[model samples]
Target chain A: MQAYLTLVRRELGGYFNSLTGYVIIASVLLLLGFSFTDMLVKLNATPTYVPLTELFYSSYYFWLILLLTAPIITMRTFALEKFSGTYETLMTAPVGDLQVVLAKFTGTLLFYLLTWLPLLGCMVVVRYYTGEATLLEPRTTLTTYLGILLIGGLYMAFGCFASALTRSQIIAAMIGFALGLTLFLLSLRSYMPAPPTDWGAKVFAYIAVGDHMESFVRGIVDTRPVVFYLTVTGFFLFLTLKVVESRRWK
Target chain B: MIVRPIIEVKNLTKRYAGHTAVSNLTFEVGRGEVVGLLGPNGAGKSTTMRILACFLPATSGTARVAGYDVFAEADQVRRRIGYMPENNPLHLDMRVRDYLRFRARLKGLTRRRSRLRTEVVMERCGLKDVDRKIIGHLSKGYRQRVGLADALVHEPELIILDEPTIGLDPHQIRQVRQLIKDLARNHSVLISTHILSEVEMTCSRVLIMQQGRVLAADTTQNLQQIMSDGGQVIAEIAATTEDLRACWEQMAEVEHFNIAPAEGSYQRCALTPRGSFDLRPLVYEQARLRGWPLRELSRSLHSLEDIFVHVTRAQGDGEGEEGR
Candidate 1:
């Protein structure tokens, strides 16, 4: 447990000590701010019944942030360690492979969560300007953040898994972006004009991150998306653990 | 009462995609012993250390560290040993003090213990001056010291250092050797280096490896002794080549002799003695009795380098040209 915490702390420190973490956070904030401004402009031109939380959560900017920031945030976890030759020292230090994978996962997830904190400020700005309390509705805001956490956790795990597959951070980032983009494209199947009927629709709905966020922003707390995200996150983390253990055999 | 060895390996073999790195190697390191692993490149020294450190798995073998099997109880073995790999990889972005503290904590030290050990090792490694400096900014010697400090911070029973002083200056190398000697007072050290004299100066026992096998393993003194027994005796005397050859042939102690012309009318005769005793006195007596002027008569002492070269070259010869 102590080793796990120390490793997690070191992983987090690795990000903050370099320019990678700040650059990621700054780029994300810049993108989010531009998207929020665009959304406000649209809202002013045409008043809609959609709540600010729903409008914000279901925007194209949300998926863009999720897809782009996750790969950047996690590309360094295992890839940089291997590149720098510190992986041998780290793995030989009495810590289990699972602990290392989980620590890195947690650290990246924590940083991913931190990057979205400014989204809350966007909500406050909305509430202050529009004088509407619904933007800050306690239940809706909480569920939206929870949904964001689940989806972000899954994407971060995918990035970490990609990072474990190679020593080059660029290759890791490319693989992570490719994986996340494929999932996003798959989820886009639900948006097709002639979407499949019955079971195919259900399958598309099951994996659609957009649909899951829409449900959460509407103040619904469903267990299916929660379980699905957690299961896939766990699976990716398991794959990373296996990759870390494979170092000894190789 | 019997004390168990800190490290024991039997029939250890590590086969990669095409070649075997370590082949049926066997050795033991007793408690508080400083063992030097001297070998040419690709002799499986690093491979063997990696297996014992639990960083690599052997194909067919059993290695036990501190009474725990390395493959089965790797964490137990890892906790008992501190390993500094080749090149001394470190977090370049971190400060020296922070890196040491982080490593200490990762090695399972408590917060308080981590702080204390970080301070202790920093002082011992002469890293206190650059504690606040980023590791990437430090010189190669200082970076190497940080790596050493990190290995020592955990206070493990055994410390595995691979080429710890490879790139250091002569003064830094001496300091590291002295530090290793000091470490031997409490903890066992397994050090591998291409520097033969460093091993002669520091190690209590030496393991000379070649082609993934132990070519020779013994006390440093004993290894030198084995080489010096048949060591050469060189003498410079004013004598003809034929006379020198005939003289050496008549001496029962001379196994083989070579006579080469020296400055003007002088001949340099090098004789390999059959026995371990010094042949200088006999050569001097022969020269005096023959009324020949003798300038130099000295038994060439074999250093660790000679023994290393001799043993490695002897093994290379035994395996024939195909082994190359």
Candidate 2:
């Protein structure tokens, strides 16, 4: 337990101690700011019945930021340690492989969530300017953040798995970006013009992150997406643990 | 009562995909003993140390550390051994104090205990001044000290240091040697280096390896005695080279002799004895009986370097013949 906490603290400190953390935060806020203004302008031009949170989630910038930031945030988790030769030192300690992997996953997931705190701030700003308390509806906002957490958790685990495969951060990021893009594209199959009305479409809809978030912003709490994200996150984390252990034999 | 050895290995071997790194190697380090693994590069010293540290597993053989099997009870073994691997890898972004403290905690120390051990090791390693400096910015010597400090923070029973002084300057090497000697009072140290002088100075026993095999394992003194059974005698006498060679050839105790002309009429003769006996007194008497003026008469004992070279060279020849 102590080893796990110390590792987690060091992992998180790794981000805040360097300029990477601040740069990530600044870029996230800038992108969200653009999305917020665009949403407000569209609302003023032709008022829609959709809530502000739904409009924010529907922005192209939102998904782009989510996909890009995950790879960036987790690219250094295992890759930097290996490149610096610290992986041997870390693995030789009395800590278990599972502890190290889970700590990294949790640390990156927390930092990923931190970059999205601006989404709440943007909501507050929208509510203040529009003088509409409905824009800050408690249930809708909570579910939206939950969806963000689930998707962010899954993507961060994927990035960590990629990082564990190599010692170069650039390669790790490229692999992570490719994996995230593939998953996002797979989720888009349900939205095709001639979507297949078969079991294939059902599978696509089941894994579709877009449809999940749409229901979340509408204040619907479904168990399917929650289970799916948790299971996939667990699977990737398991693979990372095995990778760390396999280094010993090799 | 019998005291158990701190480390014991039985036929330990590690094979990579194409080649064997450590093959059928075996040695033991007793309690409170400082053993030096002396070998040239690629001798499998680091690989053996990694297996004992629980960082790597042996392909076939058994290793026990502090009464625990390395592979079966790795966690128990890890907690009892402090390992500073080759190149001394550390998190460069961390401060010295922070890194030591983190390592202490990772090694299973409580918060208060980790803080106390961190301070103790810092003081012992002379790292108090730069405890706040980032590791990457420090000089190589200071970084090496930080690595030593981290290894000591948890107070393990055995400390495995792989090539600890490889990159240090002369001054830093002296400091590190002194530190290792001081640590010998409380912990058993297993240090590996190719420098024979370092083993002579700091280690109680030496394990000389060649091509992933133990060439010789004994105390430095024993190795010297074993390699040079009767030792060698050097004498400078006021005589011709031919005359000195003739005189040495008549002595039954002398096995071989080399004589060369020195200054003026003096001749220098080096004599190897036939058995484990001191030839200095006999040489002195022979010179006095002949009424020859003798300038230098000394018995030269073999140094660890000669034994290391001799043993490794012998092994290399045996391997060459096998290959043929």
Candidate 3:
């Protein structure tokens, strides 16, 4: 327990004490601000749509920012440790590799939340600008936040696995970005062909994180997509743990 | 020596890509013992040390560290062992105290206990003056000392140091040797190094290895005795070469004799003692009777360095295989 916390604290510190953390936050916030203005000002000129009054959904801009920042934030977790020789130190410590992986997962989760905080203002302003008192999209808004967390967790897990695969930070980031993009675009399988009947389309839909997240953003929280996102996160984290353990043997 | 060995390696083997890094190596370190894993480059000493630390798994065989099986309960074994690698890996950007605090927590100390241990270790390693300095700015010697301090703060029973003095200056080397000697009061130490004198001065026993094989394991004194070619006695005699040879051969105390130039009227005779014989008294008596002047006399035995080379080379030659 103490060992896990120690790792978590160090990783959290790494995200804040270094320039990489600031860069990710700045880039994500900038994208969020841009997309919110672009979608609100240009796309909808006439006011024919009725607004709900309560909590505004932070979905549209949130997903875009998460997609871009998740890779940059998580790609260096294990890769930098390996590159700087700290991986050997961490391995030889009394802690198990599984605990180290968990700490990284949890620590990056904290960094992701920190990056998302600046965008919450956009949520409040959207509520104010609509001139709807107590306006909210509870079901869609809640599910969208949940989706963002799950998908971000999934990306970090995938990036953690990639980080474990190599010692170069750049290569780790490239592979992580490539893998996340592939997994995010799994739903596009239907556009390419007939999918060999419905089963192939179902399977592709099952694998695509973006398809599941966007579905939640529309106010429908389906159990299958929720389970799929969680399974991907768990499976990738487990693989990361295995890789870390094998490194000691090699 | 203790009633039981602190560490025992039973037929431990580790292979890598069609090459064996350590081959059925066997040795034991007793409690409170300072043993050196002595060998040249790529001698499998580091491989053996890593296995003992529970960082690397063995290909076959069992190693028990602190009475825990390495593979079956590696975490338990790791908790009881502290390892410092050759590279002296640390977060260069982190302050020294912060690093120690973080490492202490990782070693399973509670928050309060970690801070206390951090303070204790900082003082012990003479790092109090630079506690707030980032590790990158420190000198190589200080960094190495910090590395050892990190290993010590955990208070593990066995501390394995790999190439601890690799890049330090002579003064730092001596200081580290003194520190290791001081540390013998509480922990059993296994030092793997290429410096022979470090072994001679700091280690009580040595496990000499070469090419993935254990050549010898014994105390410094015992290894010297075991590897001694034989004892040689130098004596002064006034007799001529043929006369001295004739007289020395008649005595059962002498095995072989050689007459060589000596100081003044005396000649130097090098005699190989026959099976533990003391020929000094007899030689003096013979010189008294002959009225021949005796010059300086001395006895010589093989030094540790000679025995080290002799044993490692002899092991390689005996096996008819190059070092792995």
Candidate 4:
């Protein structure tokens, strides 16, 4: 358990100590800032969600940003280790694959958290401006935060698993994005007339992080979504562990 | 064989695709013996070291490091072995001490213990002064030392260094070689390299492997026996028709000493000796008797390179030239 935290610290330390994390946070904040005064944010300020809502509406935008930024965080996590030939150094250590994977996962998640919080200026500014005028309940706020966290965790795990699959971070990121998209798209059962349609849909939805992410978007917290996030995170993390172990075989 | 083996292996095989990375390999490293794993490229030294370090599992067979099976008891094996790769793999962004401390923690040390271990390893590896420097900012030699410090921060019983002197200047190489030698006083080491002098200086025994098999696993004395068919002794002298019936006989290395065509009165001759021996001092005494000009007296032996090329070529011809 302590090893897990230390690995997390090491991973997080690797990020903050470099420009990748700062770049990611700068971009996220830049986008947020750009949306605030830009003509697009001013035009799209729907009564339902703020102008920032429209900026974040694509989800795919953040997803795309995540897809781009995540590779930088995770590319070096395993691929660079393999390239620089340090994976052997780490693997040969007394640390288990589980601990190794968990550390990387935690490190990336912490990077996400660090970046995610500063961007929450939206919530803070909303509170400052609207006072009680804002209709965001505590539940909705929690759900939104949980939604981002789950998605971030899922991406980190998937990226980590993909990283273990190869020694190239760019290739791993492509593979990770591909996997996340396929899983996300598979939830549309009606779009496909396949025979295992319902089962496929349910399975895809269960694994579809976005499906779980929608619950938080609706500002509704549910046990199913929590369990779904945990299970997918666990499964991907386990796959990362398996992939790391399988390296010796390769 | 005085048998107190700290590490043991049985028919270890690691096959990749149709080609075996390491094929039916078997060897043992005893406690406190600095064993050098000498082999050419594709001879599977790195593969073998990885398996022992618990970084890789063999396709078949088993290895035990510090009495722990490398596959089934990998965590325990890991707990007992420290490893540095041919390349000094490190997170360059992290401070030197932080990397060592993190490694110590990852090795399952508690907070206080991790700090203590990190300090000890950093101090031992001569990294105390640069503990605050980022690893990337340090020179290659310092980086390599930091890598070694990370390897030893946990104080494992065995250290597996894969070509620990790969890409360093001669001075840096010598420094690290001496460091490895110093390390061997307390910890057993399995140093894999093609450099024979590094082995001869730091190792008590050499394991010359080729084409995924052990070609020779013996002490320097034994390897010299095989590599040198019969040693050649060079004798410099300033006399012709040297009386060598009884004088050269005392030097066991002087198998057949003959006077070459002497320039002036100086006798220049060489002795084709039997079985690894040095006849320089005896030749010096022989020169003094005849008042010979003794300038250069030396014996020639095959270096690790010569030994590797010879043994590997021999093994490869039989194995159909592995990996093309």
Tens digit of lDDT per residue, candidate 4, span A1-250?
A: 8777877887787767988778878887776555444523543465444323323434445555565666556666787678777787777776778888888888888887777675566655755665543344566666677778877787788888888888887888788777766656655443455566567655655665555555566666778768877788899898888887776666
Off by over 4 Å in 1: A193-198, B275-278, B321-324
Docking class of 4: medium
Order of candidates by lDDT, top first?
A: 2, 1, 3, 4
Poorest stretch of ten by lDDT in candidate 1 chain A: A192-201
- Candidate 1 residues A1-250, lDDT tens each? 9989999999888889999999989998998898798879878898776667788865678888998889999999999999998998998898999899999999999989999999899888888888877557888889989988999999999999999999999999999999999988888888866545678877887898778888988889899999999999999998988898886777
Tell me the whole-model lDDT of each prediction, alpha carbons only.
0.90, 0.91, 0.80, 0.76
The model with the greatest TM-score is: 2
Model 1, C-alpha of B27: deviation from truth (Å):
0.6
Clash list (residue pairs), candidate 3: A53-A134, A53-A135, A53-A136, A54-A134, A54-A135, A54-A136, A55-A136, B211-B324
The residue-by-residue lDDT of candidate 2 on B30-146, one tens digit each, is: 999999999999999999999999988999999999989999999999999889999999998889999999999999999999999999999999999999999989998999999
Candidate 4 wrongly placed segments (more than 4 Å): A38-73, A183-215, A222-228, A248-250, B1-3, B225-229, B233-262, B265-324
How well does candidate 2 score on lDDT at residue B236?
90
Residues A1-250 of candidate 2: C-alpha lDDT, one tens digit per residue: 8898999999998998788899999999999999988988987998676777898987878688988899999999999989988888898899898999999998999899899898898888878888877767989989988989999999999999999999999999999999999889999998965556788888988999889989898889899999999999999999988988896667
Screening candidate 4 with a backbone cut-off below 3 angstroms (N, C-alpha, C), the clashing residue pairs are B238-B266, B238-B293, B239-B267
Global Cα lDDT for candidate 3: 0.80
Q: Quick one: RMSD of model 2?
A: 1.6
Better of 3 and 4 by lDDT: 3
Q: Which candidate, 2 or 4, would have the higher lDDT against the true structure?
A: 2
User: For each candidate, what TM-score against the reference?
Assistant: 0.96, 0.97, 0.85, 0.83
